[model samples]
Target chain A: MSTTSPSRWKTVRSETGRALTALVIALAVALVVILLTSADPGAAFQTLLTAPLSSNRTMGLWIDDVAKLTLTGLAFSLVFQARQFSMGVQGQVYMGGLFAALIAMSPIGATPLAIPVAMLAAMCAGAVYGFIPGYAKARFGASEIVSSLMLNYIAILVVNYLIRAHLAPAGTGQLMTAKFPDTAIFPAILPGTRFDLGIVIALVSALAVWFLLYRTSWGLKLRLVGHNPKFAEYAGIRSSFIMVSAMTVAGAFGGLLGSVFVQGRAFGNLAQNFDGNLAFEGILIAIVARSRPLAVPIVALAYGYLRQGAQLMGIRTDVPTEMISVVQAIIILLVASSFSLPGKKLFARLRGQKSANAATPEAAK
Target chain B: MIELLLTVFSATFFVTVVRTTTPLLFAALGGLISDLSGALNVALEGMMLIAALTAVIVSVYAPWYVAVLSGVAAGAMLGALMAFFHLRLKADIILVGFAVNILATGGTVFALSRATGGDKGTSINLPSKAVPGVDLSFLEAIPAVGPTLKSLLSGHSILSWLGVFMVFAVWYFLFRTPYGLWLRGVGEYPAAPEAAGIPVAKVRAWSLVASGALAGIGGAQLAMFNYIGFTRDMTAGRGFIALGAVLLGARHPVGAMLAALLFGIFEALAIVMPNLFNWIPGEMIQTIPFVVTVLALILFSYRAQRARQMRTLSKI
Candidate 1:
């Protein structure tokens, strides 16, 4: 046990070191892009690095971005861990937001139970929306990526149709629902900022997912299926059931994000394309976090900081904020790439030690 | 309903379907080639988008055919980059595909702003040339079916005709040649081909390049002929739809063309419905192609599963 602990610590240290290296390299790539595009590259680069910390407002936005990305990141991590590439989170967010807004505007929203009730409804909506692609993959052998993408377009259109046809107040020019009642709104946790109970919800949700993925038999079964589906099936595990459940639970997280967006001060009403590309951004966060439930929030925080800074840079300089996406793509490619670095021998030795431990009977599962 | 039927039967609607199907057909063919090579090119969306913008920007300075060729080159280069990352560096193909998409989305907007001197939403300010439509008004000189043939076939983009020829060409290349068999063998079971002394990795890499080039032609058709200018996200999920078309076409070249045409018909309906049915929201109309793609894919999967089960039962 003592020997295993040291090796595990070494592995974690090496992983962190690699991640840091990747981040620095990604930033350098971003610097090159900025230099090529921006007339005043120095200001743009500085703004991209420091703008998120310059003001309370930016800080609030950054925190909100973190909270949102964390939830979506967890959502992506769950399905990805199950080895199911479900890109339906964007659609689930739209459905979740729609249901949450509907519940919030209903007469029941006047009660103190409104937020919980609305949130529950939103989660259920998201789960059902997620179930379509999950069922398609498990039952029909359909590709979840393509099916989920189709569902995303349909979900967006459905949400827009609903907002335009039924949810929006009559005579309003915009495609948006009426604002939620004050009782339904999540109160700001910080004074003069948009931070609210959603942040707490996000953190709690992250911890919950960690416990769910690490501390439960269900998680063990899910991970077992992910590691080897044929082996899991040989061991009497229903791989299909786990895949669906993973997606359904991940969908619940997407729904929670939707509810948070609509119920919080960030958007008190549902609108067409309100989620923007937030759900898609989660995929990057999930990959960056290495699909670890516990690591999602930290990665989200780091990414959210950069994203907020990029927005500020876009506003302040000629360098487009889109430059950050170029950096992001480069980072994802570099980090996800399996290259032999100088420490490769040491890393392989540590992994060999871990594999030797895995030869134990209990570890063989 | 009668008016809708009349519109559907008319030559103009047929023209719209052909025009719409041309881009999807190109992308779908690209997707089919890669899928046959065992590498699912999810970057078709990003490739098409970037190519569309490249075509638009390049057409402003060059001949339309050269502009189209530039789009193809841009897509082929992206394919090579992806091959470098996925094959050499061992990056996951899907993640790398999404990375390309992210790059395309953000990169295109950044480039557009620079090109148009600040218009990030579109390349409207750019004086891009269009692919010349094939004039077949001479068909009217014939006797009976003259006007009908002219209306049916005339004025379509020259690339649209190329799209039809490419379908047959891809079919012949994928099935009729020894290289085609090798490509299929590589995709189906690389170990067998590797043992057989074939360059399996090279085959897959070249498949992706060809896939990207095909999708690039689709993008050129889109920006150069379909819309005449690049808008933000102008591919608008057509690349994805082409993926569905690849599957719905049963992974065959002909099947892909049919599936693309199927989606094309729905797209044409969506475009035409907004005018006829003022009662239905435009958003609902726009969803028809996506809805049909999902339904068709589900049905295709179901049938395929049944076929597999039946074959196993027969063996028993």
Candidate 2:
């Protein structure tokens, strides 16, 4: 047990080092781009790195984002651990939010049971959405990447259609549902801020996922299938069942994010185009955490801080907020890459050729 | 009903189909080449977005063709970058492609905002040039069916004609050439080619480069002709739809074009439908192509699985 603990610590340390290296490199690249574009690079950089801490309200927003990212990160991490790339988190989020709103706006929302019912509805919606791609992949051998992305577009459009047609009031001229009932909403947990019970949900979900992955037999089977499907099958594990269940569970987490977002302090009503690629950002968080359940919130906190900082920076400085995505892309590429590059190989090859030529000259001498 | 039928069957509709299909066909052909070489080229979307932005920005100062070429170069460079990460650095191809996409989505907007002096959404402030349409008015000189022939044959962007030629060229290169055979062999069984002294990695890398270049032209066509400017997220999943086209076309260049044309027709219908059917929600109509893509892919997967089952049974 002691031996295993030391090795695990080593792995954690190494992962953290690698993540830091990627972050530093990504930030350096962002700085260069900022210098090229901004007339006041100093101010932009300072704002990007520091502004999220400037006020309590900003800190509240940052913490709120942390909660959302933690949930999304878990959603991606669950399927990643099973070696499946669902990418349906975005669609699932939409479906979850739509169902949550449907429940939250109904007469049941006025009752004390409103929150749990809405949450369950959202999870079911997200699970159903997630299940479609998993079923398609398991039974028909369809590509999950393509199917999930296609479903994402369909879900967003469907949600938009439903809201515009059925939910929006007749003369409001807005594409949002009526404000959700106060009882159905998550009340603020902190004074002077919108931060609420969602953070607790995010933390509890992360803990539950960690327990499921490390303390449960199913997690072992899922990991076995991920490591070697043929061997897993030989060992009598049903790989297809695990794959579908892994995706479905991951999708439940994604669906939960929907209810959290809708019922959270961020927005009291369901609005069109509210996600703004938040689902995609979860993939980045998952990568940064290396798909480890316990590491997800830690990574989410760091990444969410940067995201919130960038949001504030966009308002205050000449730099655009989209700069964060560039940094995100660089971080992902660097984190996924091995340290050895082709440049080193080419350099070594050229040196070898030079040494060989020198040896021939010496022989001639 | 008569008016709708008249519009659908007219030469103008055919022209619209060709115009819309040109970009999809180019991207689909690109997707086919890379897929044949064992690279999925998911970065096609990002590459196209960057290329479209590049083409528009370049057109502000340079000639139209030069702007298009710049777009192609940008895409090819991105492809080379993807290849470096996937092949040399041992990164996952899908992840690398996604990274490129994220970069393109955010980076293009960043660059566009700088280029347009604070307009992050579009390049409207820039006086970008458009690809001149190929006017085949000379066909109007012919007596019989002159006007109809002119309408059918004229006023397409020059790139649309190139897109037609490229379908045949890609088909020939993928089937009729030794290099094409080598690329196919590499994709099918890399070990066999590697044993025969083929540079499998280099072939894949070059395929990715060529794929990116083709996607770049598609982007140029989109920015310069289809819409005549760059808009945020303007590609609007066309790159993804092109991937579907590649599968629906059964991995063949000719088939890819036909599949692209099929989608192009659906997209054209979406554009034309709002005016005729005002009662229908525009969002629902917009989803038709994506819905069709999902259904088509599901059907294709089912058929392919059955075919495999039949082959195994016959062997037994």
Candidate 3:
């Protein structure tokens, strides 16, 4: 009991130390970017640090960012946990949103039932999109990274073509779909914000993901396959089926992310470059969250805050919001790195000590 | 249909093919080098984007060659950074590459806005320099195919000539040289080379640098000569297409060049296809190259599988 408690303390200490180092590096990079680029670093820093909460409108925008980021983060985390790194989530998001928009604008979608139908269409589109890569990986032994990336461009093109050909109004200028009907519109929960129910949906999703992953046996099977597919196969588990299902589930969520983003706004329609790289950002969020389903909401919030605050800094100061991406990149490098910074060797030593206690069973033998 | 076919076979179309192929060829060579060194430089897109912007901004103040060199240097430095992070710091190569990619996406735009005084979309405002093309008008004085050859070969950006020569150079370096052998050995089976006293990490590090420098040249050619200036993400998906070329070309240098030429043909077709088929949306026409890339990759995999099956059948 005594040894277990000490080792648990060691685990927490090491984790915190690593996260702190990454956080420090990220902040330092952000600081340098400000000082080097901005004419008024002080004001930029203040706005960047506080602007997400500065006003009700900005808060609404921040919430909107969180809602979308959280969904994508969850989508990425699910496949990541299964050790099937699928970059197809964003493609699914693209397909999902395109389909949702298509359905929302259809004749049958004019009724009150349109919104749910649209959402379901998005889920199915995204899931089917995801299933392609998963099935290829499972059956053909293809590289998901490469295939998903290729599919992303395909999805972008397909959606672009569809929008340009059919849904786009016979107009003079821009190629975009007709505005979604009121049936597909979300009612704003907060009085002042433009976006609504998205945050609530995202929060509910986070809770559902937590429950599904931590409290369910299917989650156990998925984790087992992710950790060691050969071992899972040896135990009679169908790893290929699990991989396909996991990817399909991820696609559904990713699709839902796009729908939430589009429907929450008054102009609920698909644009040319509709992806906005939320899928890639979701990958970043998952990495930062250490691929934890439950930790996603909080991390997504923090990311959303940085992004929203950076937007404010762009408007209020000379700095560009792109600076947040620099910070985000540095954080990924530092967090993903196995090399503890010079002083952080102490924590690694602590980790080694904790592992040594686990060796006691062999020592007993 | 005849006119469309004529358009496809015209000398102008071949020139377009050469122009488009040059950047993809350079990037394909870069991807090939890193791939053969056991490090898939997935950051090729990011590296090219940063290098394109760097060259475009530098050209506003410096000579074309100097700007191109600066772009190469920037890419090499990034390669070194990737090596430092992935090798020394023990990070996953793909993730580190992705991080570099994400950095490139935002960093180039930020730097571009700063350089061009807040024009985030395009570098139309920069007083950028272009690489001069070599003249081959003398070839026209010769016999029958001379005029055709002159039309195909003359007026290509000087970098396009370098791109052609690099095919032989990279092939020689990879197949006919000892260092190339070491790089390949490191990629295929590192333990054997390590046992033979070769420094695997150093070879990998140099390969990454070489890869970056090649991609940098591709970026330079695209910005300085392909279009005479940079636009936001002007490299587009050339980097990824280069990866596809690496495989579709059978991971050989000559194959890569040929595959790049193949993709270039499609891009050229896209450019000319719009004029012939006005009914088809231009946006749909633009998708041809990307669609071809996905199809080519799938075909490549299928062919490889069939070949493997035949080999095993014969062995049995």
Native RMSD of candidate 2 (Å)? 5.9
lDDT of 1 by residue, B76-189 (tens): 999888888889877778888888988998889988998998898989889999999999999999999999999999999999999999999999998999999999999899
Instruction: Name the regions of candidate 2 deviating beyond 4 angstroms.
Output: A1-3, A340-365, B1-4, B143-145
Number of the predicted model whose TM-score against the real structure is largest: 1
**Tens-place lDDT digits, model 2, residues B171-289:** 89989999999999999999999999999999999999999999999999999999989999888888888888887788899999999999898888778888888988999999988
Whole-model lDDT for model 3 versus the true structure?
Answer: 0.83
Ranking by TM-score: 1, 2, 3
For model 2, how does the per-residue alpha-carbon lDDT over A69-114 read when each residue is reduced to its tens digit? Answer: 9999999888888888788898899999999998999999998888
Winner of 1 and 2 under lDDT: 1
**What lDDT score is found at residue A1 in candidate 2?**
16
In Å, what is the interface RMSD of model 2?
Answer: 6.2
Task: Give the C-alpha lDDT of model 2.
Answer: 0.87
Better by TM-score, candidate 3 or 2:
2
For candidate 3, write residues A1-365 as lDDT tens digits. Answer: 12488875675455556666787778888988889888889999999989888788888898888988999999988888788778887788888888888778888568888778878888898889888878867765555666777788778887888877777887745678767877787778877585587888898888887777667877778878887889999999999998989888888898887788667763477788865676788877787776767678888888888888888898888888777779878877776776555644467587775422231110000
Q: Output the TM-score of candidate 3.
A: 0.93
Order the candidate numbers by DockQ, best to worst. Answer: 1, 2, 3
TM-score against truth, every candidate: 0.95, 0.94, 0.93
1 versus 2: better TM-score goes to: 1
